[model samples]
Target chain A: MIWLERLLAISAKEARQLARDRVTFGMIIGVPVLQMLLFGYAINFDVRDVDAAMLDQSRTSLSRQLVGDLQATQVLRVVREAGSERELRELMQRGNARVGIVIAPDLERRLFEGNRPAVQLLVDGSQPALEKIAQGLGSMPLLKRAGTSATGVRRFEIRTEYNPARRTAVQIVPALIGTILTMTMVIFTSGASVRERERGNLELLITTPVTRGQLLAGKLLPYVIIGLIQTTLILGVGRVLFGVPMAGSFVDLYLGALVFIAASLSLGLFISTIALTQFQAFQMAFVTMLPSILLSGFMFPFEGMPAFAQAIAQVLPLTHCNEIIRGITLRGATLADMHVPLLKLVIFLVLMFSLAVTRFRKRLD
Target chain B: MTVAISARGLTRRFGAVTAVDGIDLDVPRAQIYGFLGPNGSGKSTTIRMLCGLLVPSGGTVNVLGHEVPREVETVRRKIGYMTQRFSLWDDLTVTENLDFMCRIYGLDGATRRARMKDRIRSYDLASHANQRAGTLSGGERQRLALAAATLQEPQLLLLDEPTSAVDPQNRRDCWENLFALVAAGTTILVSTHYMDEAERCHRLAILDHGRIAAEGEPKQLARDIDATVIEIECADLTAVRRVLVTVPAIRSVAQLGNRLHVLMHRDSADPERELRASLAGQCADARVERVGATLEDVFVAATQLRRPDVERAA
Candidate 1:
């Protein structure tokens, strides 16, 4: 019974202290919300709908069909139709299209004679991932058409400009920005609360009749809200300023951000509970954040990485967040489509949050 | 007759270091009990254990009749702890801090608000109710800490070095509030390093190296040592110790500023005769006078006996 009183005292004290401090409350709420707004809009992971211009030397039905197929894929939207290859190159240089497709003449003669036809694709390498995805999607229908012809007529050329090979930054920037916000919000709030404890203000709080559960919840709630705000901001900015598309539903993106926020906050709380000082908290948070970014597929493709990296990614909340965010934004996937990753995020939140609460309460005890 | 706080052989250890060794303590309702110890001598540890902030490694601690650790929550609610350092929310207004505390304690809306206001008024903080706690002076901050701790009207109040940094006037004022609480049937267990603060308690225990070296009414602990401390002023201190050390009754010799205090048992060392003889033989002019033993003397002797190595290490 006395133990209950003590818990109440501690909880009450924490609530009181937090309620009274406006800056801390702002830091808890405003920082995360601002970051969410910043990150949600500013960070985009999926490469979609690249603006394109085309040069068609053969104005035949075959050329039209090919152009139509390219447009049908939804990966490329033709911004301009060029009369000559020179004009197409000029358009590409003038930033008319990130990608340019050139179809050679005599394509109709080859089709009737049952001989091979030639085609060429040009892409700006400024963003390698988009260019790569564009090239892959650009070749799909032509390759399928050629496969149907048994007469050795399946030949095409794909030439990429700017970035000859897709670089990592095209895939990394959108997610890296979000992950950075997550790291900052979680570490800041967790360290702030723990610093108060180390300074012994926590004792003043415990003697006031607060429950550990209430205190922990109160401390975490503000950060969660803040994390959400950061997600919103990042997504908004990512879409508008950086041309990062939000192909997925806002709700789907939100759910993903929520899980990520909870996991990060809980991890932070866990660090705070175990640490003796703010420096220790910072060290632990950095340690957790570093591995999270490295193994979460933010810096590397999960598929390209070795099996060990894949397995490591499975255990990190960042891995699931990255997958959820990328899947939703890139594939326009619904929540149901992200069942496995969403489930993983849920389990991470529940387990990590429970453990953090247990450890934090135990410290008071 | 209510025993507001009780501990029997309460022991707490930090790994291999026993912060609070086996000890017994009891405080009747309305009594002020003080714990006196130097830094790291287990004063704060004992207070924490009593307030249910820390669980004892061995034995039982019953606060307000509730067993600790098991009923820590209950014990915690019943005790108000004002820690040695200022612990109020620096960014919050005084009223906000108090209200938040009340809310956490589950006090109802009207009651919580009214009690917070009353506390503010009582502590003479009404003018600063809207001022952030961080902006308050040290004395005001101390009052706020006290007010925040007492918000729940706890039956057992535990104050650990509550007045260490406060000015003399504020310290006296803080003590007055403590007395007021005691009169209202609150049992207070306070720990301090100040001799004057220790004297304010109804009963006190001097702890040294995690052990209770001496405990009782301050006057009684002083009387128990029963050493007639004589102040001797001499030009040559080495010659005085040579003559005084060999005396069978000279139990302790301590220096106080420029004067040397010779503590002698009543049976063997007569201060009047021995002082005159030593002065005539030493061939130096010196003045010696017997003085009643103060609590500081008793504390010094008890602490010395508990840790002889401290002196050797020094």
Candidate 2:
């Protein structure tokens, strides 16, 4: 009973201290909302409106139909008209077009003559995503129709599953929940202990009847509440503002989120133990944030990264969290479908908190 | 009297530097026991060890019938510790800070409210109750700290340099509050650098280089020192000090206000005549007389044991 009371007392004190610090309180809420909104707009994977220049040498009805088909796809917008292939090359070089299409002079004549009409497509391969979409979108329809007309050999169709509209906001907003949670929870948890130690309030606490485990729980309880608020704000903004839907179990998503929050908060606690000053702890938290951004596959696809990078990502709690969130919001995955990610998150939480507790020495020495 | 805090050969070392060397303590219950020393004298270190905030590299410490470092948590529950720096939450208001401490000490419900109200009135912080602790004056902050420290109603209170930052009148008020605590049967083990503050303690231990050089009642420690203190009033105090230092019988010379306090060897039968002869023979006009020793003299004597000249005098 006394242990429970001690925990409650410490939790109450921590809650009051957090409420009194208005600036930190504002940041705890504001940072997640702003980050969600910013990522919703900035992370567009759809990659539309590729500027293209055309060189129609045949000038026939058939060539006109081919160019119309490319424009209908909406992936490539034909922006400029070039008289010759040389002009199209110049347009591609002068930054006027991301892609160029050239039709042979005898394209209709050859097609009616039972011979193949050769068409050339040029693309700027600087950005890999745009290159694949541009090439596939700009030529696929035209090639399929022309090839079917000429021969009956190859036949296949492309179908997009999950997030069929390929909305960038949909993809980004769900993942932003994990990224934003990681950033806020790690910073707030690490900063709380370090700030107390730096400001000398820790001396008063250490001298009390409070044990180390009680102190850890008390210091982290208010942050768990703050983390929940941040999660709700990000999810609300993502759903209302960006139209990001949650297709899976809310229970599953929040369970994963709870584990992720624990891992990150304890990670912050671990950093605070090593960092003598709050500023140093802040820097360490930021350094951990970097890995969440790049290695956690939040900005990139997990399957697309190399094996070594995936191995690195496997250790980061954010990687598992991002996967869990995306699986729930995008795929409508159940707890059974995401047992690996869910279990990994639990493991991360247990390991991180154990290490943090070990590192957090009760004595000042 | 029951011993509230006692230690045997308590020691604490940081790398190559030993902050608190082998030392022992015996503090009686319900009295103000002071630890007087200069900065780095291990006063704070010893108190921290007693409070169980630090683990002694070596020692046997028992506080309020609890063995420390093993039963430290129990020791912590029965003692209230106040550090030199403002350890309470600065962002919290006076009332909020006291309330927080009350909760931490497991004070609850109406009892907690009553204790807070009593502290707020006695510490003279009734008007400043809602104001932030950081915005309070030094004296107000000190009062608020004391209020928080005593909120638990612990049997022993450990205060580290509690009056170092406050003004003279506030210091006196703090001592008055300490005396009030004593009257209520609360044992206080306080550390201070001020001689006047040390003199106020019922019993004090003078520390130097992490060792206890002397320990007794303030007056008794002053009266029973190994040397006689002589006062010389003169125009040229610098010359008087310099001339009195050359005398073989004079152990140490210190200037206080308009008079030069010269300490003579304990065996010297007539310290006043000896000082008068030394000043006149050295062509300095001065009137000398043996005066009763102050705690300051006892402190100087205890600390001077570590000095080379004072060692040579022995």
Candidate 3:
């Protein structure tokens, strides 16, 4: 009973202090909403309307039809017409166009002879995603459309699942839940211990009967509620604006989020014990945040990374959180299927909690 | 009398510097004990060690019959510490700070409510109960801090330079409150450099350079100082000071208004006569008379004028 009373006392104090801080209160809600909109609408992997230069070596109707067919795919637009291949190369070098299409002079003859390829598609290799899209044009059945008997040409069918429309917002919106939670929850308690020490409150606090566990738990309570609210805001905005389907149960998502939030706060508290000032705490938090954003499979493919980098990403909480959240939100996964990541999060929470408590000495040095 | 706090061979070092050297102390029950010293003289450090807020590098502390850094938890329940700085949450209101402290001390609902009301009224904080602690005046903040620290009514209270930021009137009022607390059978250990405040203590420890130079009642320490005091009234006090500095027996000389207060080695049989003999030819009009030693003289003898050679000879 006494422990509960002390815990409540510290929690109430922290809540009052946070309420009076206008900037922090505003940041709690403002950061999630702003980052959600910024990352959702601004990032697109399914590139379209790439500027292209065309070189027509032959004035036949067949060349015109070939150019029109490439445009019909909506992947490239003919912004410039080049008289020579060198001019098309210069156009790409000057950054005016990202793709180039050249129709050979003997296109009709080459189609009949079948000795060499009739059309050549040149793309700027600097943008790899655009290059992949431009290469897909090579597989189009141009001769078959021209009333020629098409011989043996290998064709493969590609189907994109979950996100059938290939909307970037769909992928980004669900994963934003994990990103936003990591950003806010890690920073919330990072400065807790340093701030108390800087304000001279630690001296008086340690003299009282409150234990370290009670103090840490009390400070973490309010921020957990704040994290849940931010989660709700992101989900609501994502559903209404982006039309991202809720394939999973809300209860399962929130449960996973609860474990992730606890783990992040424990890491923050551990950092708080290590930093001596608020500024240092913020810098250390940023150090963790940069890796969480870049290596958590948020913006990049996790498996495509080098072995060492993937190993680094495996240790980040957001890495597991991203998998769990994306699985539940887009793949409609149940908690039974998410036991591995959930167990990892629980282990991280315990490890960080013990580290923070052990590092936080009851007496000042 | 029961000892409220006792320490032996207490020492703390910060790398190359020793903040509190090997020291021994015992604070008795229900008395206002004071530590008088200048800045960097280990007053705050000593107070922190006594309250178990800081662990000593070497030595032992037994506070409230419980050994520190071992039984620190039990000792914490019986002690209240007010830091040199006002450490209450500045964003919280006066009432809120007291309420939080009350809850932390495990006071029941009825007792907490009653104590809050009582403290607000007694500390003259009823009018500004809702105002934030940061917005209060320095004096008001000190009062609020004191009120908050005493909410648990612990057996011992450790205050570190509590009145340094307060005005004279507020300082007096604070001392009155301290006396009241002492009368209620709560032992208080206060540290300050103010001589007037030190004089009010039942016992005083004069700290110097990480060591206790002298310890006793203020009046007793003054009477037992190792220097002879002689006041000389002269028209040209500066000239008198210049002449007195050349005398081998004189330890220190200070100008007080139009007179010169001279301290000579206690080995001099007649300090007043010796001072008059030394100034006879230079300025015969100087009036030399024996005077009683003050706390300032005691401080100078214990800290500034007591050289290594003099200490060895004594």
Q: What DockQ does every candidate get? A: 0.31, 0.72, 0.89
Model 3 residue-pair collision total: 0
Candidate 1 CA-lDDT value: 0.75
Q: On DockQ, who's better, 2 or 3?
A: 3
Q: Which stretches of candidate 3 lie over 4 Å from their true place?
A: A109-116, A139-144, A148-154, B308-314
Model 3 preserves the real interface contacts to a fraction of 0.93
Across B136-215, the per-residue lDDT of candidate 2 in tens digits comes to: 99999999999999988999999999987899999999999999999999999999989888988999999999999999
Order of models, best TM-score first: 3, 2, 1
Please, what are the lDDT tens digits per residue for candidate 1 over residues B1-314?
A: 47887888888899899988898887778989989989999999888887777878998988888888788877776878888888777867888778767766677778888888888877889899899888998889989988988888988888888888789999999999999989988888899999999998999999988888888999988778746778888888778888887676666788877678876755654676777686678846777887878888888778864344355468
Model 1 chain B: lowest-lDDT 10 consecutive positions: B304-313
Give the Cα lDDT of each candidate. 0.75, 0.84, 0.89
RMSD of each: 8.0, 2.7, 1.7
Kindly list the interface RMSD, in angstroms, of each predicted candidate in the order they appear.
5.4, 1.4, 0.8
Model 3 TM-score, all chains together: 0.97
lDDT of 2 at B278: 68
Candidate 1 vs 3: which has more DockQ: 3
Rank the models by DockQ, top first. Answer: 3, 2, 1
Predicted structure with the largest TM-score when compared to the true one: 3
Query: What is the descending lDDT order?
Result: 3, 2, 1
lDDT of 3: 0.89
> Model 3, A237: alpha-carbon shift in Å?
1.5
